[model samples]
Target: MIPVLWHLGNVVVDLVLDVPALPERGGDVLATRTEHTPGGGFNVMAAAARQGLAVTYAGAHGTGPFGDRARAALHTEGIGILLAPRTSGDTGFVVCLVDADGERTFVTSPGAEASLTPADLAELRPGAGDLVYITGYGLLHDSNRAALLGLLPRLDPAVTLVTDPGPLAGDIPTEALETLLTRSDWWSCNAREAALLTGLDDPAEAARALQSRLGRGAVLVRTGPDGCLLHHGGRLVAVPGFAVDAVDLNGAGDAHTGVFMAALARGADPVAAAHRANAGAALAVTASGPATAPDAAQLDAFLN
Candidate 1:
């Protein structure tokens, strides 16, 4: 079988709104624009699929309209949905408020995605050399967290686990968080998450410290439009990113990660993969909507 990229993360709909600025604690503001689409873990799988990597979403989808959208988006992207539709509740959604500077604030209302069991995890069935993508959201909920921890050690040793400590990184229990990072074969996250994990405010320091703990594994700290800091094989290098006028920062990190994993699956060098990821992210941010990572041809054109 071709090496597959399995996403053991939640997929949800995003209700995105464009605003001049964030509202105060007891304030209100009108949105300049509004959009609704499948987001969260979906972005990574979509980006990977765009690069011709076979991808699968091994998470729960609910029984309502939101779940319907998630399933439709996955099918349109040609990504396989590994788990059956969840019945307890509809798939969840997040309200994203984008400010003028492209920063975002999110308010989430979780549903069926927060619930998972050992039985649900059994369907993951990853193959040797397959890539497993884990988002921090999976570790936030009690049920999902237990299921993931139990399934981690059972995964085939040949499978490479990539964990991205998302915005929820701070809320994850210390022991569990450390365990996840220690067990991961590859760790990718933004500068804020790097600090939250390592207690080092400096991105470079956090990258070095985190990479050292991985033994033979690698770590990447994304720095937005400036690019990323990649620490692998005892060397840390700043992989320059393509600078662009960022209209939206949503899905940029996911684009970078999906492209990076696909590159590694295709046997590209780590540094070269990082370069592609950075370029792919730059292209993603230039677009207004999420799930905007470019195809191979677009990436090549940008690089050339």
Candidate 2:
């Protein structure tokens, strides 16, 4: 199988607090419960690692409790860490407030992960058949934006570049976003991000617009429980999502992207890969934390 090199510097510890509802301004509400877990980039990389993919995380870890926990979680999942802790700052963390309906709002404190340098990118030597994954969050921070942009031209032409602009898709600089669209082999994002990027309300139209921009690439528009729409090889296909009782919607998209990339690396066709991704995402939502993606056996059982 081809290696999946995940450029995931956004790993963080998530402190999830369950609340009855969002508190109004100046009002305080007590949380019903709290759970701490590994989140952010770990959600994506762990999802692929659990599927038995040769996954490597090319990112920085910081010192402190958050970084310690993050390292331990990666070790537990059998994922490789190619980068060492270089930053003096502590690892980042987020306070996730989940409401009764499972909707979550996050307040984040970014740290060392937001300071990726160009030297870090130069160290990554991806070759043909390797898939490189990046997210929009990496582009949002000013400290890392130039580094990420510089890394793009240095990437091997034979390497497949996959990107998910995430919810901050609209906030990315126009030039950077254009470069990514032109260079990306596979572009994946949720419906809201699609609309923001292409200004198209219909997902199919959004997918088409994005595909056209890619010239020789494909586009995937993930539409929550309704599943995803794919535009590839001049054809538009709708991949239906699996029906499952969703307990936590967080990280579902990350799970889908991870599994989709893993399946493709293992020689599955686009539609077949999408099916497995759907199953993996369904299973992810049935669990609580952001890093709750299923392993190969669990994914197979769910599909069966």
> Which one wins on lDDT?
1
Could you tell me the TM-score of candidate 2? 0.96
**Candidate 2 residues 226-290, lDDT tens each?**
88999988899999998889888888999999899889888899999998998899999998878
Question: Best candidate per TM-score, number?
Answer: 1
Quote each prediction's TM-score. 0.97, 0.96
lDDT against the true structure, per candidate, is 0.89, 0.85
Where model 1 places Cα greater than 4 Å from the true spot, the runs are: none
Give the alpha carbon lDDT tens digit for every residue of 1-304 in model 1.
Answer: 6899989898999999999999899999999999999999999999999998999988878999999999999999999987889877999999999899988888889988888777888656688989998889988988888888888878888888999989888888776677777778889999999998889999999999898777346899998888999888788899998879999998899999999999999989889999999999999998777789998888889999
**Number of colliding residue pairs in model 2:** 0
Candidate 1: global Cα-lDDT? 0.89
In angstroms, the error of model 2 at 239 is: 0.2
